[model samples]
Target: MFDISMAEWSQNAPARARLLLVGGLVALTGVLALVFSLREPGSIAIAEWWPAASAAVAAALCARKHERPYVAVGVVLLVFLGLLSGGRSLELSFLDSVGNAVEAWLVAAIIAARRQQLSLKTVADVGRLLVATVAGAAVAALCVATGAHLVGLDFAASFVPIAAAHALTIVCIVPLVIIPRLHFRVSTPPKTIAISGALVLSVLAAFYPGSPAPLTFLPVPILAWAALSQSMFTAVFQLIGVLGGISALTIFGGGPFAYVTGAVPGIAFLQLYSFTLAALALLIGAAAQERRVIERERLALASLVRGAFERGPNGFAVLQEAASNWFELIEINAAAPALVPDSFEHSAGQWRLQRASRLHEIISRLSAGTEQTFEWSAAPGAASTAQLTITVGHQPNGSRTVVLAITDLAPMREAQRKLEEQLARERAISNELRKLNQQKDDFVASVSHELRTPITSILGYAEDMRENHGVTADEESLEVIERNAMRLLAVVDDVLLISRRNSDTSEPPARRRIAVGRAIDQCVSDLGRFAASKSVEVHVKVAPDTYLYVPESDFARVLSNLVTNAIKFSVPGATVKITADTKGDEVMLEVEDSGRGISREDRDRIFDPFYRSPQAIRDGIPGTGLGLPISRDLVHSMGGSIGLKSVLGEGTCVEVRIPLVRPEATQ
Candidate 1:
């Protein structure tokens, strides 16, 4: 629609070219009108038909070029020249010419403003042109009547003839010139041309000089034929030819209308007939064009739908829902024919009998407007089942077509079975590894428990021998043996603790409301001898009455381990700071030491069982590496967390957070 409106002559041509075209058309129209006017024997008082006719054609062409102003100026100049060539005096000629120019300007202005191109693709386009022609002719008729009255003539006598002649001329000639140029594809089929030629010849014969008046109706059916079979441009030219033939016969006083006495009355009847025939032809032609366009679009959509359905991979079938919940097959693609034999069968019983119960469940869901999918095995009991995946979709419509798509699922099912088997094997291996780990922990626990008794006995005998015997030179060796025995006992105790914790499924320790500050003080006092032996200062900064809801023994063990590590790692003159504070329902305890800090690489494994940093090993630290892992387990068992942060060459700080017991809750 947008393309049609913008198809003006100036769209492709430059301004100068459009101007030249308009000028040439205007000059040619003027020359034709002048020649036609010379053949009229009427006085200047009568309306000159040629000037009105010529102006209408020229105005339509200029409007097509989108030059309305040029149309107005050129039309007035041409009308004036047409009148002057007919030998009219200057003053009278100018007044009459102005009226014709105004009529032409009205036609051009209306068409340009509506942006209506001079093509008849629809009935509305033809109707709009007809209305504009009538309106412009009426205004020009009034102008001609007013001029005639001033020249001492009757207004009614001149107005009617001038209006009728101008209206008929525009209806016939303007379309003849404009439609041909605007609608470029004007070819008709050979059969259509032959039919139109025959119709024109028949209309001419009907209006022959000696023909009866009843024969004049013969052209009506012929005109209808031309309208339906030929292009709109051809249909229009046929109507024009029919009108011209009637006019030529009537002018020679030979046609049926010529039998009437007066020329005006006879010509009026002929013009009325031509007007009615032209309108009918235009309507029929527009309708035919619209029908052709609709048919083309319908065929295009059908082709696209058919191609999509045929190209699909899965078996596709459409079933129409019928009475009693039965579905009748409506359409099926190529792949579907092999899946279900006897394509024209209406019942679902045949296909349903061969498929499994699962396929029936999916179809039942789809019938209720719920999309569903399920798998069907063609050979259910075979070792390698031939499976198909069927998807059912409900299409919304009066008939309620259900579209079913089927795909083979044998390959996919086989792949899924292999994956499941692999997963089962991995689970079996993981369970075996877990049983072996439990056995290792049990062995470690048994060994540590047995060694503890022997180590204690050795320590006692070493001490007793040194005290009971008289002073000897080997006293230093005996003291060294006793010191090593106590260290071995401590190591044995740590191993037993870790083993028991891992293997035992014991209940958690009872939560007791105890002052966390008192626990810190106890841990500091117990480790005081160790700190003194190393010459390291121990500082305690715990808030008074800071209480936690945790087992007192676990809290004490956690604190003792952290403080002992801090003291062991510090330099001789450095301080080990132990602080505890309450924050938002939790007790935060921190043990900081001014010692060589752990490296970034060793921090990740510091809490693992029997794991120690390389720096600690290099320094020949005197302790087992189970302290941190035991402390972490004890803290976690009492609903608390422990974390360590350190910087190389700076210091190490360990933090523990345990839930604090509120005073009100303890009461």
Candidate 2:
């Protein structure tokens, strides 16, 4: 099935116009042939018979190469058909129609093949088109000379005129049709009207009667103006108009070429005139078009670069190198003025007078083609120490410029000053704290010493009274006094030891290897009476051969304090477990009591000096609240750690880990 839509699109306005142009050209050729035959008396002939056909084919071919072959063939066939139908009774033969089609095809093919070469921008391009026209016309003239010979006409005479005529026709017509289609440009209506008027007036003046023979050259200047002021399309159209005017004048024996006596030579001279004018118009017009395109591109690129330079955040400046290694400021963007106060000066001068010596060295390096970047500080007497990052860039023309980025360092300097003041205040407060701490240690040592002498006397007297006398009515009272006196002495000793530990001049504890099992056994034995008074069961689990690298007296005190606290807190019949075990490189001792445990709120403060749990105070447990804290200090001095874990109403556990002694090292 045929698609009617295809036919519809092919017959659109542009397509229809092309068809009309081709058909009209073919009809015009036939009509001009008949008219020329009447002008020549006795024989019917065609003047430049195939010019319109050649132009139609060339126009179609130049539209676009991919469609050229199809368009050229279609137009050529249509023109041939039109010629045959119109010239049936005009002495036009079938061979003539065939020859015209062949000539059109030859010219179109040569032009299409060398289309790029015929850009008319250079003299070479115009020369190539002229050569192609002459070659194609020579081939077609052979057919015309053969036909003239068969008809017994002058073949030699007819060949030159026919060839020249065909060449001239194509030079004037093809560019008019093809250049306009290829390089179409929209021109102002007023400009088009003005150019058209000028063209008409020039053609009339060049060909009008009684004008000098050299006056025909006047149209050459008009054609040159059209090529320069208008597009290639407009220029080619004006050339065709001038050609028409010259041809009409020559045929009437009115123009310079028409003054020749013989018809063929006169027509040949006319053809040459038209060919020369057409070449000039086409070549100049093409060069003008190329120049316009280049100028437009240059302007667009300049605009783009200027916009980028203006909107950039960083300052930019260009300097031109001058005599004696000096520089002249050529250009600077908007941001450059704020960076350098006198940046807008056009004269050559040393703009770096305000810059530092270091900045001058950087500029010297840049002039030697070495790029450099460094921080610069402004000279004194400026508002502030302007810290600037200066970068030096070198150009290819031995010129250099320095770009400065200023940073205000005043806020940073202010913050640093405040920090220094804060540090000084803290140092003063720290010294005062040290002095107070020293005084406090001295007071504690003095008080413990003062209280210790009396406590020792009282303890000695109480021991003597209990040991020398027999059981009496006041025996229990004596026992009570002795027990409390010993406790008070232990408290005093703890205070003295803690004070010594805090003092700078205090001596370190003397470390010795002692059996861990024996130490724990002695602690349990020492706390046996206290456990009996409370009716608490003391359980001892000591790992045999376990030893500790610590002071014997200090270890004994730590064990005694833990065991005493465990027995005091435990209820009657509750077990107080004292376990000593070796764990890796450490000896761990635990004092666990199944007693009223510490509350969560009091656990953190359990080892603090003079701090006791609420349960101990409520139960009237006799304690100075110094046992655990003193034990912690002693353990830490021996390079050990002490910790407590307790659950309310469940039990309390105290664990102490001390570094174990190697028997071999001790030996």
Judging by TM-score against the true structure, name the best candidate. Answer: 1
Residue 608 of model 2 has an lDDT of: 86
- lDDT at position 26, candidate 2: 52
Model 2 regions lying over 4 Å from their true place: 1-42, 46-51, 59-92, 114-128, 180-202, 262-264, 320-329, 338-667
Top candidate by lDDT: 1
Instruction: Give, for candidate 2, the lowest lDDT window spanning 10 residues.
Output: 1-10
Estimate the lDDT of model 1.
0.70
Q: Judge candidate 2 at residue 396 and give its lDDT.
A: 74
Q: Candidate 2 versus the native: TM-score?
A: 0.47
Candidate 1 worst ten-residue window by lDDT? 1-10
Residue pairs with colliding backbones in model 1 are none
> Per-residue lDDT tens digits of candidate 2, residues 1-667?
0112111222333856645654555555555433444455455364743455455445444444454455545544554455445433322344444455566666666654744422344445456667777887787677666766676767788788777777777776665444423233536778878887887887777777656755777788877887888776667777777788777766665667667665556666776777778778877877776677677678879889888776765556655445444555555566555444432433354332322334334444454434444333344355544344555566676555655454445567789899999999999999999999999999999999999999889878878887898779768998798788888888888888889988999877788888988888887887777778889988888888888778899889888898888888888899988888889988888899998899888998988899987778888988888889899988877777899899888889999887775344332
Q: What's the lDDT for residue 194 in model 2?
A: 87
